[model samples]
Target: MSLFYLLAVILIASAIFTITQKSPVYSVVGLLVNFLALAALYFTLNAEFLGVIQIVIYSGAILMLFVFVIALLSSGVGPFRAGPNRLPRIAAPALLTTLVAFGFLIFGIAQRPFGPLPPHRPTSFLGNVGDPNVFGSVGDFGVALFTVQLLPFEVTAFILMVAVIGVVLIAGDAVPQPTLGRHRPQKRAAEREPILKAPAP
Candidate 1:
């Protein structure tokens, strides 16, 4: 088998393990491994920028968040109960739909005409910087991001900030209060007597 196919199988296996693992910590680690495998796949596809982003954003930031959340909630052990049931009620219909979708996708792929692969041209960034004449460069991406996609990026940042705030609020301790029917005792001079007093002649 080709290396690509081997990596794809490993990626799929890791993803399955990630979902099936009972422990949240192990699941997060599996997800991290899956992300790294995806990054490798992206590198194989010649998408270096996307691969780096996958490693930095998904593997680094998001996985760290998951780890932190697991550490905060877990007590170094699995839960007694595995929580509520997640099985779908209409399993038969869901399975039939999935099979039909897979069949249609395979039929579409089979119907595609095969042709000789086109030759690849080297991509250059420095040569096209600030050209305004050619496209497909780092400058073009920067321009698009700042001008066209600025609002979406801003919204995403706001959403992340709100999520962080929500997590913090949920993890914070509740306000302390006196026990039921209990009152604070008043302080008196006698009650406040010093433990050590100087002896007088």
Candidate 2:
């Protein structure tokens, strides 16, 4: 077997293990390993820029979010149970979606045309030597964001900001007030005696 195929097999196994793991923390670790393997695969494909993005976005940002969510929602033993029918309800839709996606993928792959790709002059050298904005450079990205796709870029940023704010608001503690200890008995207002009473006629 080729080295790439072997790596691909390991990657698929790791991904499946990550999904099926009972422990959220362990799943996150497995996902991290999967991301690293995917980055290695991207490198093998000679897509250095995409590999860096996989590390930065998937391995760094998304994994951190997952870890934070797991920590917030669970206490290591396990998370709280949902309604009895939740699994079946969720599972049906998920299975349908998966089948649909697989069908589309098979159809597309079968219909894809195979031909020699057109050759192009390398842009990397000119970008490195002539242009100040090189390929995959921050400056080039910024220019593209503001010049070509300014509105969409701003909209995406706004959506992300809203998402962050919503998460913070949902996770924020309610206004804390003084509280008696958990075991302490609560005093009833009626328990206190009236200060004054009318005299008997």
Candidate 3:
């Protein structure tokens, strides 16, 4: 239980850090931490295949792609706005709605009557007749992914492909200098004019 809590905390913190981080590289690192945490959680849950997939696909491949795209597109750290904005106001209602929805979901789940939980071993279907305890096994994972979650799996793969294509398209061209937002950004070190020192009398 403590391990579960620890993993959950790390995952949430890393996810928040990913979004809140200033440097894109640092953000990517934070996301990597999130991916690692998720993989660990899967391992704890005895989902070895999912843990491997999480580490290989998300942490190794996708994040490397993100880093490559960022490096290819941007020359250096660019100017960023520094001030309060309407973004929080826009997100607040959606966040509140989601929280309320989750509250209802939890309440509903808690209301269900409890039964004697199955044994600690994994469960398997008759199709793989030889292996009785094959839950989270490769065969079970493959069956579920192809049969039950086929559409979602395909959609996710398509989305990833589109993201890669989009990144390549954007990075292939010379990116334009971004215009400052409502707030004036601080001048870069090279951009600031040095003050002339007065000669000693």
lDDT of 1 by residue, 17-73 (tens): 997898888899889889999998766755566678899999999999988778766
How do the predictions measure up, each by TM-score?
0.56, 0.60, 0.60
Question: Cα lDDT of model 3 overall?
Answer: 0.81
Off by over 4 Å in 2: 1-4, 72-85, 118-152, 168-201
- Flag regions of model 3 displaced more than 4 Å: 76-89, 114-116, 122-132, 146-201
Q: After aligning candidate 2 to the native by TM-score, how far in Å is the CA of 115 from where it should be? A: 2.3
- What is the per-residue lDDT of model 3 for residues 80-168, given as tens digits with 9 covering 90 to 100? 33468777787989789989999999999899877764677543332443344666767777877787778989999999999999998
Candidate 2 structure quality by residue, lDDT tens digits, 137-166:
445555655776688879999999999999
lDDT leader? 3
Please provide the root mean square deviation of candidate 1 (C-alpha atoms, Å): 7.7
Candidate 3 local Cα displacement, residue 130, angstroms: 7.6
Shift in Å, residue 103, candidate 1:
2.6
- Each prediction's whole-model lDDT (CA): 0.74, 0.74, 0.81
Q: Which residue pairs of candidate 1 clash?
A: none
Shift of residue 50 alpha carbon in model 2, Å = 3.0
- Looking at candidate 2, the ten consecutive residues that score lowest on lDDT are 121-130
Q: Which residue pairs overlap in candidate 2's backbone?
A: none
Instruction: Give me the displacement of residue 85 in model 2, in angstroms.
Output: 6.8
* Candidate 1 Cα errors over 4 Å, as ranges: 75-83, 88-97, 121-201
